[model samples]
Target chain A: MLDKDIKKNESADNFVLRLFVAGASANSARAISNIRSICELYLKNRYELEIVDVYQQPLLAQQEQLIALPLLIKKNPLPERRMFGDMSDLKKVLKGLGINEVI
Target chain B: MDYSAKNKSKLNVLPKTPTGISGLDDITRGGLPQGRPTLICGGAGSGKTLMSLEFIINGATKYNEPGVFMAFEEKTEELILNVASLGFDLASLIKSKKVSLDYVYVDRNDMEETGQFDLDGVFIRLGYAIDQIGAKRVVLDTIENLFSDLTNESIVRAELRRLFQWLKDKGVTAIITGEKGDKLLTRRGLEEYVSDCVIFLDHRIVNQISTRLLRVVKYRGSTHGTNEYPFLIDSDGISVLPVTSLHMDDVATSERISTGITSLDSMLGGKGFFRGSSILISGTAGTGKTNIAATFASSICDRGEKCIYFSFEESANQIVRNMRSIGLDLQKHIDAGLLEICATRPTMFGLEMHLVDMHKKVTEIKPDAVIIDPITNLVTVGSVNDVKSMLIRLIDFLQRGQITVLFTALTINKSVAEQTYEAISSLVDAWLLLRDIEFNGERNRGVYLMKSRGMKHSNQIREFIITDNGLDLVDVYLGPDGVLTGSAREAQILKEHTGDVLKGYQKTRKDREILRKKKILEATILTLKAEFESVEEELNRTYTEELLTRNILEKNRKEITNIRGTSSENNTEENGPHIET
Candidate 1:
C-alpha cells in the first residue's frame, strides 16, 4: 500500500519532503528559509513540505535516526534521498533532490 | 592563599562518581571525574563496549543512578544480547526505567551532506532520554562512528567537541569510547575533546595467552594509578586488578593457626603459621605438596571456618579422592559449606583472570583461609615473573581481608626452583620446602622450614611420611655418614638398640665369674688355718710328754738315792735334758 501511494504521488509529480530541525535554532531557521525559497522557485505548487522540530518531538528525531541538524528527507520520490546541513548550497541541495534545471 | 585553606579546598575539589566495577574504582581512586566525560580508547575487540556497558549497568543497579546508553556501532538489541553473558539483564533495567538505550544508526550510504550541519539531533535525543529517566550517567559507545558516517571531518570533530561540552553542562558523568589509532590515543582524537579523564584498555597475547589490561592514562584533578593493571572479563563482567596495594602497612597478628600436621607444627615454633600470613609450600613433583595443601584446607574447615581451595593441577573430585586416601575427608567439609573446591586448568585463563577469579570467590565467600594447590602449573600460562606478580596481588588481597593462604608450588629444576622461590619467598611469612631425600636407593620425602619469619623454627629436615592415618613428620636420623631416612634410619636405630642389650649381658657374666673365684679363695684359707692349728697342738703335746718322762726318770733316780731329793746340780741336769727335748 505504501508503494502504491508512492507510485501515485510520483505519477502526479508531487514532491514530499520532511525537514527535521531543532526549534528556533539559527541553523534551523536558515535551512527552513533556504529550502522554502528553492522549492517555491523550482517546484512551485507541486511540492509539499513538513517541518518537524526535534526539540518538540525528540522521539521523532530518534525514529529518524537523526545525527545532524536540519536534515531533509524526500518522501514521495521513487528513490528516497536524505541531505544533511542547512540547505545553503543551492546547487548541491538541488542535485541531491534530483532537480536538474532552474525554473 | 593560606596553605590550610588550599589543602581543605583541594580535598574535595574533584568529586568523583564511583564506577561499581571491581578494582576499577580502587585504581581510579574513587572512579571517574563526576559530571564530566571520560574517553576510553582501545583497539578493536579490546572490551571497550563491554566496559562502558558495565559502567552504565553498575551505575543504574549499584549506585541507584539512572543511565542512558547510546550505541553508535551496535544496535540496542545487539548491545543487550552482548552483555547477557555477563549476567546483566539490560532489558529488565530498561523496563524498570532505570536505564534507556538509544542506537544511533548512521549509515553513510543512505545520507548526503550538502553544506554546514550540527549534531543538535543527537543532543536532543540524548537530552530527552536523560530527562525521561533522570539519568546521572550516560555512555556514547564509540562515537567515533560519526567520523565514518559523515564525509566532513571538520563537522564531526566540531560537533563532538560541542557534544562533550553539552554533556558536561548537563551535569552527567559520561563515558565516550573510541577506536585506538596507530599513533594517537583515538582514531579521531576524541581524547582531545573529552579531556577530564582518559583510560586505555589493551588486549594482547603473550606466549599464546591473551590478557586484558586497563590503564588510567590521565585524570585531570585527581591522582590515579598509572600502571597498566590486568583485567578479566567473565560471567560477572570486567574486573581490573590493582596488581599491588599502595601501602605495605598491613597489621600483623601474633595469633597462630594449625597447619593440620602436628609434627610439622612443632617444626614451626610448636604452633603453626601466623594468622593472615601467606605460607608457601614448595617442593618437587610427588613430594606431597598437594597433600600438605589439602591438609591445611581441612584444618581450616575443621575449625568451622570457611576455606576455598583453588586447584590448577587437579579436578575437584580428584583432589577430594586423593585427599581421602590420606585421611582428609574434604567432601564432608564441602557438604558442610565450610570448604569450597574450585578446580580450573591453568591454561584455561591468563594469570590475571585466575587472580581475579580467586578475588571474586574470596569476596563472595569471605573465607577464613585459602589454598592454591600447585601454583607452578600457572607457569604454563605466563612467565615466572607474571606468576609472581599475580601471586603478589593475590596475597595482598587475601592479607587485607585477614585470610590465611597456603600456596603449593612445584619445583621443576633445581636452579629454576631456587630462582622462582627467590622471587616469591620474601613475599611470604613462612616458607616450607619439601625435597626428595635420595639415599639407600630410595626416594623419601623430607621437609624443612626454609624460613619462618618472627619465630624460632627447626633447622633439621624431618622425614615426611604420608600414611593411611595422615601426614607425619619424623625426626630424621643423623647417622655417621649423613642424614638417614627411610629403612636406613630404622635399621640404624635397631642396630644401636641391639648393641645396648648385648653390652649389658656381657657385663653381667663377667661380674658373676669374679664372684665364684672369691668364694674358692675363702675355703682354701679356712683349711690351711685348721692344719696349722693341728700341728701346733701336736708340738705342744710332744714337748709336754718329754718333760713328764724327764720328771719320772728323775723321781726314780731320786727314790733310789734316798728319795732323791738330791741336789741342785741334779735338778739342773734334769732341767737341761727337758729343755733339749
Candidate 2:
C-alpha cells in the first residue's frame, strides 16, 4: 500500500477523502476510535481518512449524503471507499479500502 | 447577501420558521425570518400580545426552538399562570431554561414626575436576558405598555427607531408587539417602518362570526406567504393553519360516510362523503337540520374520531338533552373526550372577537370533526355578506388542519334550503339540504346531499325518523306517494286498505262461477234418468202382450177355422201399418 501511495504521489494525483459521521455524540466517539485503529493497522501510510462530524457541521454532513452513522472514507485511493459501524471486520475494511489483497 | 465563505453559503438553505398557522404562514412562506425582528402591530385586544405569546410558546415547545418572552403588560407570573390555563407550561419551561419570561412595568405616574425617560433600561434588560439564555427567539409583548404617554410624537418616534435598530443589531429573532391605532400601524406607527418585518393582527365581526386575521404587511429580503391566516389559541397554545384558497393545492379525500340511508348513499355514487370536507346543512326551523348535524357528529365520534359541537343557540346541557331525546348518546362521547360541546351566543361579544375566541377554543381541543350547530344566530350581529365571509374564513381556518366540519344554517325563507342570497355555497366542500315537504296532507322531514366534492353521496332525499334510538334513516320511502312527508306513512296505510277491498271482491266473483256450472250438470242427468225408465217399461210390456196375443191367436185359430182365419191375419197386418204412419 505504501509503495502504491508513493507511485500515486509521483503521478501528482490529488487525494480526495470523505467520512460521514452521524451527530457528534458519545456513540460517534466510540465509532471514531475503531476507525482510527483500522486505518493504522491496514493502510497506515496508504490512504487519507476524512472524518466528518454531522453534528455541528450538518451541511457538510448533508454534502457527503450519508443516511447512517460512523462512516469512514478513504478518498486518496483512486476509488472512494466507505465503511460503516465501527469497522468491526478488519479484513473486509482493509479490502474495501483497496489496501490489502486477501486470498 | 454575504457569500464569501462556504459556511455562510450553507445558511441560505435552511427552511424558515413555519409558525404552523392556518392562512398566515402561506402568506409568509412559513413564518418570520429566523434571527430577525418581526413587529406585530394591532389595536387593543386585537391579539398582539396573544399572538406573540403564542408564537414564543409554540416555537419553544413545537419547533425545538427555545425562546424568551419579555412582557410590558401584566406581571410575568400572572402571564405565566394565565397562559397555563391554555396548556402552556411557561413557568416550567422557564425553570428548564427552555423559555425565560420577564415583565417590565411602565407607570404613568412615575414617568409624569420624572419628565425624562430613556430607552436604556429596556435595552439593558433585553440584552441581559437574551445573552443569559443564548436565546434564538424572543418576544417583547405590547410596546404600548412601555410608554407612559404618547403625547410627544417626536420622542416616541425616535425611541421606536432606536429600539428596532438595537434588536436587529443584536441578531436575535424578536417579536415586538404593539398597539394598533387608526392613523398608523401602531399608535406611533414608527416601529412599522423600521422593523425588518411587520405583521398585523385583526379581530373583527363579519356575518356574526368573529374572526382573527393575521397579515404580514412587509418582509424584507425574503419571499413570504401573502394571505391572511386564521389562528387559534387553546389549552395547547397557538396554531395557525393555512386556509385553502383558490390558488393552492387542496388534496381531495376519497373516503366517505353514509347519510345513514343506503338509497341516499347510492345517489352519491356509492361513496358517502369526502374525508376532511366541510358540509353545510341549511333548512328552515323544524326541518331537523340540527338533528341531522348531531347524528353526523355522533357517527363520527362512534367511528373513534373526536368531534366538537359549537351551538350558538342552545346551552351545552340543553343540546345534549335534546340530542338524547332524538337517540344520540352524546354524553358518553363528552365523557370520553371524543366530543366537546361549546354553546355560546354570537351576541355575547362583537363578531370579530367571537371568531378569535372560537379560533382559540378549536385549537385547544383539536377535534377531528367540528359542528357549528347553527351559524344563523351569528347573523344577528352582522349582515349577510359578513356572515358569508366569516363562514368562509372559519372553514378556511379548520379545513387546512384536515378536520371535517359540519355546519348548520337556518333558512330565513322556508322555501329554499340551498341559499342563494348568501354566496357561501362555493366556499364549502359539501352541502346537505334538509327540508320539510308538504305532501299527502302532511309535512315530512327529508335530507338530501346537495354536493360532495371529490366523492359520491346520496342524491336522493331520505326520510329520516327521529326515533327513541336517534335518527333512523328508513328505507327510501318507495310508496306511491314518494318520500313521505314526515306524516306520509298514514297515506301508505290508506292505500293498503283499498288494495285489500279489491282483492276480496275478486275472490267472491270466482265462487259464483263454480256454483252455476254445478246446476247445469244436474238438469241433464234428471232428463236422461226419465227416458231410461220409459224404455225399460216398454220392453216388459211388449214381452207380456206378445205372450197374451200368442195364446189368443191359438184360440182364434180354432174359431177362425169355423168363422174366418182371414180376420185374424188382417188384424195382424193392420197393426204393422199403423206403426209406420
Candidate 3:
C-alpha cells in the first residue's frame, strides 16, 4: 500500500513531452525556445520536460505520424494532447494540455 | 585572371535555375545564373532562335518560372506554332500567366528608309512586358535584326554595353541572340565582350552532309566545355551536347547484346557489343557497309529498344524501302515509336548544323541507339580537320549520354574495311570491317571485328551473307589446304587421291603376308597331333606285357601257400608228443 502511494507521487512529478520539427527553419527555432520558457516559468519544480529534435531523429518522428514541424505532444498523464503552430500562445497551449485555467 | 571578387561573400546568392537539358547541365555544372543576362550568338539558320525559345519555354513550363519572349524577327503566332510541334503548349502557357510572347518587329528596310534608329524603344517595350508579368526569364531573339549595316560602329558598341547592364540590373536571366558573319562573331562584335557568357552556334555542311554544332566561346567566373558539339533542330526544339570529350572515367559494360547472328555472337564472347557503345562499320562501295549497319540497327530495334537512324545520303522513305527489300522492315517499329528515321543530304546545310540536328532529334526521341548510315558522305563539304572535329564532337555527345552510336564509312581499298586515315579510328570504341575476298571463282563477303573495347572478338574472318531473314555469318572454313587458296585447294584434292591409291596397295601386301603366316601355323599343329598318337600306342603295348608276367607269378605263389598250410597242421600234432616226453 505504501509502494502504490509512492508510485503515484513519482508519476505526478515526472512529465514526458516530445516535439516534431521538419527542418532547420527559423520558425522551428522560435517554437523550441518558447516551449522551454513556458516549462521553466510555471512547472519547473513540479514536472520534468524533455526536448527532442525531430530532424535529427526522423524515424522517431515518423512513428508518431508527424506531418508538420513545431508540433508539441504531451506524452505522459493519460489522454495525451497535441498542439501545432508557432507555439507562442500560452493560453491555447494550456487549454490543449487540459489545464482548465492558466496560472 | 581576376581574383578581386573572391573576398566578397557569396552566401547571399540565390540558387541557380536548372536548365533540365541532358548534357547542358553537366557542362555548366548546374545551370545558368538564376537572374543574369547570357548572350547567345550564331549565324543565320544556326539555331539561335530555336535555342532561345527552348530555354524560355523550358524555364516557364518545366521549372515553373514565368518567362517573356521578345522576338525581333519572328511573329508571336509563328513562334508559338513553331514550338508547338515540339510538344510545347505555348498558347496555353501564355494564357495561364506562365509565358508571354512578344514581337519587336525590327526591319532593316524600315531602318534604311528612316536613316535614324535607336534601341531604346526596343528596351522599353521588353521592360514593360517583363514588368507586367513579373517574368524571371527573358529572351531577345536575333537582336542583330535591329541593326542597320550603315550604323556607326561606336554607337552599336555603346548600345550593346548599355543593353547588357540594364538586363543585369533588372535581375532577370536574359538571352540575347545574334547573327554570325564570316569574319566577325556578329555584324557588330560588341556583345561578345559585354556579356558574362558567350555561346557560339555553327551550321556547316561537309561532303553533302549537314551538321549543327554549339560551342562555348567564353564563360566568365566558371569553367565550361570547350569542344564543339553536334546538335539537332526538329519539331522538338534545340538540344546541345558537349559530347563525351570531357576527360573523365567512363564505365565499360561487359554484358553484351546479341548481334542477331549466332556465329557472330559466339565469336564475340558468346554475346555481342556492350549495351551502349559506338560501332564503326567501314568498307568500300558495294562492300555491304550499309547492309551491316542496317542489320544491326534493325535487330536492336526488334528487341524493343528505341533506335534513331540519321541517313545523310538517303531519304527516310528510300532507306526504309531499301532495307525492306533485304527483309528488314523498320516501318512497324516506326509506327510503334521504337524507330525514328531522319534523312538529309549533308550538303543541304552546314556540317555543324547537321550535328545540331542530330543532337536535337536524339534528345526528343530519347532513343537507346543511333545510326549514321554513312558518315563519309558528310566529309565532302569541309576540310579533313573540320570533318574530324565535327565527328569527334558528335561521338563525344553520344558517348556521354551512354547512347549507342553506329557510324558507317566508305574505305578507299576494296579489301580494306576501315579508314586508314587515322583521324577517326583512334576515337572510336569498336570497329567492324566488312571486305570482299575473292576465292573459288567467286567474291565472298567476310566480316570480322577489328577491335572492340572491353570485348573478346574473333580474329579470323568469317563468311557473312545477307539472306531472306537477315545477316548470317558462317563459320571460318579452315581446310587442310591452308586458308583455302585456289591453287592450294586443287593441290589438296590431288594429294587426297594419291593417298587413297597408296593405302590400297599397302592393304593388298598385308593380306598376302597374313595368308602365308596362317599356312605355316597349320602345318605345325598337324605334326604335333601325330606325335601324340604314336606315344599313346607304345604305352598301351607295354602295359599288356606287364599284365601277362604278373598272372604267371601269382599262380606259383598260390601253390606254395597250400603246402605251407599242410606243414602247419603236421607240426601241431607233433608238438603234443614232445610235451609228454
Candidate 4:
C-alpha cells in the first residue's frame, strides 16, 4: 500500500516508529505484536522501532502531543503519520504510514 | 412466564463505596456504585468538581484506597492549588503515591483531528494515572471540555461512553462530571450513558442569596434520599446535606427544663421542655423573642451543659449586652465555656448550608442545647420548602444527639393563618407563642402555650413581661368583660380596690349612727323611771302614815271612833292620787 503524499516527499527510506502503551493493556500488547509482525514482514532490516509506556513516561507522552493510546507514529518515513487503535489492519497501518508493498 | 421472579434472578447487586462525607453516606445508604461510573452534573460553581475530588481524596486517606484524578479542563497544579485551602494536600498525596493527577489539555483549535481519532489519547493518560497509583477510585473532572468547539458530537459521545465502560471493566469506581444543560441533566444528555448513578448539583440565586443544592436523580439497586439537599463548599470542602430524612421515632424523654420563665414552666405541665425535644417560640417584633432565647441558652449553660446559640439577629456581644438589661447575664456562661454564640446572617448562605454549618458546629461542640434565634430569617435565603426541609434536618439531627433545641421565629402576624411557613411549627415537640395584645390604647405582651406534644399545658393566656429582674408572668385579669393585661389590668385592679374601701367606710358610718340613737333612748327611759319611782315612794309613805292614823283611830274607836274616819279618807285620797299619776 503506497500513499501519494509519501511518494511525493520521499526524503527518508528507513522507517522510525514510536508506539505508545499503558501498562500492557490488551490493545497495547496486541498493537505491539502487530507492529513487530508488520516490521518483520514488510520493512524487516529497514525499520527502527521504539515502544513508549505512557504510565512510565507520561511527560514524554504529553510532550509528543499524544492523545490516544496504542497509537503508532511513523517518524522517519519522509513525513510522519499517526494511526490509532491496536494496528490490526496490516494494509491500513502500512498505507497510513505511506509504505509500498513488502519491501 | 414468571417474569418477576425471572427478573429478580437476573438482577445484579451492586456494591458501594462510602464517600466518607458526613450526611452523604447516610443518605446514599453506602455510597456511589462501586466499579461503575457515577455522573455528577451541575452548572458552574455548583461544587461539582470539588465534591468529585473530595470523594477521591477521602477514598485515599480514609478508606485506604488510592485514587486517580484526570482533568480535561484544569491543570494538575491549578487543581492542586485550588483545593489547597480545603486542607487537601494533593502534592503530598501524589508524592506518597496515594493519588495521581493527570491533566489532558484538549484545546478546540488544536484538536481538529483530520482522520479517525479515538479519545484513547486521554484514555491512555487516565488509564496510566490509575495504573501508576493502583487507584480504586477515578475522577474525570469536567470532561465536557472535550466537547467544546468540536464538530464531532456523536464520536465524542460514543468515546465518553466507551471510556466509562472501560473504567468499569478495569473495576475502578469513577466519577464523571458534566456541565448542566437547559433541558437535560448534562449538556450532551450524557445521563443516558451514566446509568449506574446520577447526582445533580444545583446552584442558584433566590431572593438575591446564592444556594447550592444536590439531588440524587437516580441510584440503581439501592434506595437513596431523593430530596434536593443543600450542599456547602467551604474550608472543609463540599458536603451534601441530606435534608428531610425525618426520623420521628426517636425515643421521647420525660426529663424537662425550665421554659426560661417560672410561670411558663408551670404552664408546660410543671416542667419547661422535654429532653431532646424541639421548642419553637414564634412572635412578632418586640415580643421578647431574643430575651426568651437568651434565657433558654443561659439556662442550659447554667446547668453545666454546653449550649450553642445561632443568633441570626444579634451578635454575641450584642446579645450579652442586651440580655443584661433583663437581668440575665449570658456572658458569664460564655466565659465559663458552657455557651457558644454563632452569630450569622440569614443571607450569609442558603438553607442547606445553614443546616450543614449547624451540623458541623454541633458535632464540634457536642452541645446539649441549641438555640437558633429567629429561624424565620432563613426564609430570606430560600423558598418556604427549602427552609422547611432544612428545619426538618436540623430537628432530626439535634434530636438524634438528644440535644434540646429552641428556635425563635419572627412572624408578621401571630395568627396561625398568617404564618407564612408554619411547617417548622409542626415539626417541633412544643410550641410557645408570644403575642402583642393591643388593648385600651396600649400594647402588651402575652404568652400562650400553643401546643406541647406528650405533655399537658395551660390554656390560659398569661401576661408576659420582661422586667429589669427577668421575665415575669402575671395572671391575666378576667373581669366580667374579658381578659385584661398590662396597664388595663392594673387599672381594673385599682378600681376594684377603691370600691372595696368605699364600701367598708359606708358600713362603719351606718353602725355608729345606730349606736348614738340607742344611747339617747336609753337616757330618756332612765329619767322617766326615776320620776315614777319617786311618786310611788311618796304615795307609800302617805299610805303608811294613814295606816298608822287609822290604827290609832281604830284603837281609839275602841277608844274614839270619829277620829278614825277622817284619817282613813285622807290616806285613801293620797294613794289614789299616786296611782292615777
Best by lDDT: 1
True contacts kept of each: 0.87, 0.00, 0.00, 0.21
Clashing residue pairs, candidate 4? A67-B121, A68-B120, A68-B121, A69-B120, B556-B559, B556-B560
Return the DockQ of model 3: 0.00
Worst 10 residues of 1 chain A by lDDT: A1-10
Deviating ranges (above 4 Å) for candidate 4: A1-59, A62-65, A69-103, B1-13, B107-114, B117-120, B148-162, B383-386, B413-417, B421-425, B529-581
- Model 1: fnat (fraction of native contacts): 0.87
- DockQ of predicted model 1: 0.70
lDDT of 1 by residue, A22-87 (tens): 989888999999999999999899887888888888898888898898899988665778998999
lDDT per prediction?
Answer: 0.89, 0.67, 0.69, 0.82
Best by TM-score: 1
Task: Between candidates 3 and 4, name the one with more favorable lDDT.
Answer: 4
Residue B579 accuracy (lDDT) in model 2? 37
User: Weakest 10 consecutive residues, lDDT, candidate 3 chain B?
Assistant: B108-117
**Positional deviation of B328 in candidate 4, in angstroms?**
0.7
DockQ-based class of model 4: incorrect
Model 3: share of true interface contacts reproduced: 0.00
TM-score against native, each model: 0.88, 0.64, 0.59, 0.78
Candidate 1: list runs displaced more than 4 Å: A1-12, A99-103, B1-12, B515-581
lDDT of 4 by residue, B136-210 (tens): 999988887777734557777888889888998999998999999989999888888889899988897877777
Per-residue lDDT for B74-115 in model 2, tens only? 788898888878777788889878787876654332111112
Q: Which candidate would rank higher by DockQ, 3 or 4?
A: 4
